[model samples]
Target: MSKVYILMGVSGVGKTTLGMMLAEELSVPFYDADNFHSASNKEKMQNGIPLTDLDREGWLGKMSSLIPEWQSSNGGVLACSALKEKYRNQLAGGIDKDLEWIFLFEDFSIIADRISKRKLHFFNPDLLKSQYDTLEPPDYGIHIKVENSPEESLKEILQKLNMPEFGIIGLGVMGKSLALNMAGKNFLVSVYNRREGELEENIAQNFVDKYSDKYQLQGFDDLKNFVFSLKSPKKILLMIKAGDPIDEIIEELIPFLKTGDLILDGGNSHFKDTERRLEKLSELGIHFLGVGISGGEDGALNGPSIMPGGSKEGYNRVKDLLGSIAAKDRLERPCCNYIGPGSSGHYVKMVHNGIEYGEMQLIAEFYYFMRYFQDRSPEAISKVFTEWNLKQISFLLEITADILLKKENNQYLLDKVLDIAGQKGTGGWTTVAALEVGVSLDTITASVFARNISAFKKHKNQVRELYKLKNKADLEITDDELFKSYRSASVINHSIGFELLRIASVEYGWNLNFSEIARIWTNGCIIRSSFMEKLSGIYDSTKSSHLLLYPDIAEKLNEDQEIFTRIIPAILSQGCPMQVCSSALNYFLSFTRENTPANLIQAQRDYFGAHTYERIDKPRGEYFHSNWKPE
Candidate 1:
């Protein structure tokens, strides 16, 4: 998706100067319309003659012919004094390429002064009035005031197009927040939602009313008007539900879209579905982007970690816009980039959710250990979590502490919430993908299973009454020891998640950058923490297969492994199910061990099914069949 920009206005309005500056800034070529004029036309203009439409037909045709060549390459900026409506229509109307008309507006007095100072120019200052008289102000182009310096004008032009830059569908919480975020950055944003009922219309109107004064925001109830309001290379972002609703919207929007326009899905869509959509849309010459947006509602309002993947050219078209709205890390780098081709962004986000499930479950286990084994109240447990957070534990731990501290009518609010945690299926997607890729993601898998187990409240109650079990153990560990064990468990959980990403990257050809992933997650995300910053630094310097294999991480895990060993027995005896933490500990042990008992399992397979096994005496890939089954 290359784009052509035509800078248009009456003569002496500084279109050529500004067009040259814009071309230089965008790294594209610039062409002055004067260069394409016939020598006879130049001579006539030099003699203060106003050229009629007949005299301009050849010049306009030449500009129109060059459109395809520029679009096939990196695109070009052309400075032309296309004062008549018919002239602009001849130049840009019905073109297959994306052509934007940028009209540089200037006051008559300013134009007169600029022209009076101009030396060696063909157009006379006396002819300026005639030029203005012939000018038919464009109803479709971007009008930029030429009062500011060229650099400032170009800066404004790049960020704020004449028409709305984004047309956002589905005005839910995330959609509204993102619209407001883009508006706050001085972008013209058009927002829409399906007109389901009076309630839906009111919701959309309320959002527009709230921010219309502060930013250039518009709300449209009619879909056709909304689509018409957007500029070319249209970027329509869908923040609707993941499955059939998205398909429904696309089907409705296809009639309003043109070739090379982009449709970005910012929901937690299934990766396979995204891949299918990408292929389907590409057949029509439309680009479909699978964008992974994290950070929840608050993050959407402020900044969020954005992962966009689909067509590379489509990403290039919106790169600057995404960078402008994305959250910045401590180093002030935008936490957004082109993840890869196809559905890689959604895949990465799925794994992120899987890791989040593991992390939250581990925190729950820690809370249970404190509440049951140590007999600690909510406030006391919150205090411990707060202390660990100050030591750079994790954002999840920090938020958990705050959640525990929240109270209503002097009673803790968390205690009143339901025990059953709801999932939107991203965690399940990650677990399934791990199975497909032949990777071990046991800690995350256990976390997903834990959520299922929590749903069986009736079964648990019946089993508890039938057994009448009374196994209880007291934990006498110091707070420091508990904190170390928690930190070690957190590292192991993240390690498994990153290893899953590594395996999937190879299996799917995503070429995922582990360091960038850590960097982007350091802020504006649910799992953000100072630990991610450290992980980024470690990953940047080393190419370790597993995070635990990193020397610094290995040392920390080894130092805290003792604490985990001493505390697990006490915590488990009190009937606290440490699913995620216990699984992480086991995975850590298995990963570090050089040998396991899998040889016996292989022997049993060969004995029963005549399957082959590799012998120690033979080189790798050489198989031997066992005769232990009396075959």
Candidate 2:
């Protein structure tokens, strides 16, 4: 295990600085556990007051359990003021740190002087006396004599720890580059590979191969042998292809994995696969994560959108190691925040793809109209789509416009594309789930249908050949009528899709925050738009079971019936299924009716429950038994 160190002292005691330097001296990472403090603790600290022991207990517990896995592999130093026996006890139970503490202590006057000189930050200088007052000198091991210079104290502590460093798995382009990046961050890395060639490459890539001494490149020939090359708990980030290759490697490595061993699936794996892996590995007591590594290869080596989903316990283990390497959110919080259960991360990714499908379809439809029906050239269509990105649509759609503008293979490739789209399992899963939960996935289903129809070269051919009949209505349509009708129809269809999403979210117990989901998509996944933000907040102001009734959203759809009206006629003319969208629109419209299919069904329900039916124009509110009995 890596050297487990905690920079213990008050706010102004220079914990962050000493911890960074000490970890650097030991050639390991540093986790500022204080950064992991919850909102309330942070607020308490910001208020220039010391947190009561009761207030700090759970927070300390959380931070303490976090450092073990980092230490379990190549240990790193973490900064937390383990000022009390209880606080240290809580951390001791949770983190399983083997009673190792290089307590960084300083005089109250010195700490106050150090704090007053620093620029404004979260911690308060006014609380300096309170921290010293609350401090409990640890029943400790090696103590850094911080009575001297910071560097001297750090050097004394490192000498005691006798820190030994190692490299990382893989030494090819990605592995080699990652090694360099870590080393650039001043971390000594041990690069490993299945072949000797990879190690050679890593050595060369290291500028002048300066890290030849720290670089411990070894062949992954034997499981135990490879395991020995790394430190405790063996933090192996499997950066291989997602699916079977990962599965096969895990099977080979399972036997050698220790109880607290950690395996991070930092690949483009589906969430379900992550879920499956978590479940399987948990039985072996091996911790695993389906970490969604966004930013592609470059992002992976530098920084990426890392959506890690697994046990909170496992996350605690490696929390110290991740540090600033993780992506930050809008709150300046680590993007490495735990998603949900085993596959919750991948599940989010799936929904990401599903929404992506809907967004792309919407853009595609817009592109199609501009190119053919509107009689615009590819360049003109691209320009219009690009212009539309200026609106509040999410990053998903904005990036889509970028993708549209880029020339592919010397073609306005979008124009050359067939009317059909391709899909993986996500879009289908969304629709299937909608059906299972009795939710109408109008847009998503329609996208799938469109993709299916794209494979209709023969059907298209036959339809063209059999086009003896002419659509007299389409031929006679005016511009006003066309836009008005089509726009309204599109609205109806879109409403139906959203309604399904709402219903499914409710039924499945996702506590689905349409607003939050929309906010995230504003920069991620697909269908990220300002419209979605408006849509997300729609449910916030009202508890309407039906989204079609949302006044603001409804206005957008209904205000211009001219455009959507075309969708209905076109769908009807083309024999496409409009059940998801149209059925929803019709459901809303018919809500005003006193006698509905649902009411009739309710009558049928009473006919079975009590064999009773209600009268249409009854003066009294009473149920009546069916007079017509079975013969």
TM-score of each model, in listed order = 0.79, 0.58
RMSD of 2: 12.3
For candidate 1, what is the lDDT? Answer: 0.86
Residues 1-631 of candidate 2 have per-residue lDDT tens digits of 5557777766666678888987787788888877778888888888976788777777877766666666677777778887776777787775443435667777777778888888867788887777677778763345565787778777777665543233355444555555554555444344444434655443333432455565423334344565545544556766666688779778877887777677877655765577788889999888887755444345445644455567666666556445345444455544345554565555555555555565556556555544545456766655655555554334544565666676778877666766655776677876775677686566667767777777777687688777664322233334444334423434444455555556755654444444444344332323434565565567562344566677885676566544444454564454334433453345445642566576678666766676566677885677787644567
lDDT of 1 by residue, 514-557 (tens): 88888888888788889899988888623547788789998888
Each prediction's Cα lDDT score?
0.86, 0.59
Cα lDDT, model 1, residue 267: 98
The Cα error of candidate 2 at residue 68, in Å, is 18
Q: After superposition, how far is residue 460 of candidate 1 from its true place, in Å?
A: 3.3
Q: Where in model 1 is the C-alpha error above 4 Å?
A: 1-5, 8-161, 470-472, 541-544
lDDT of 2: 0.59
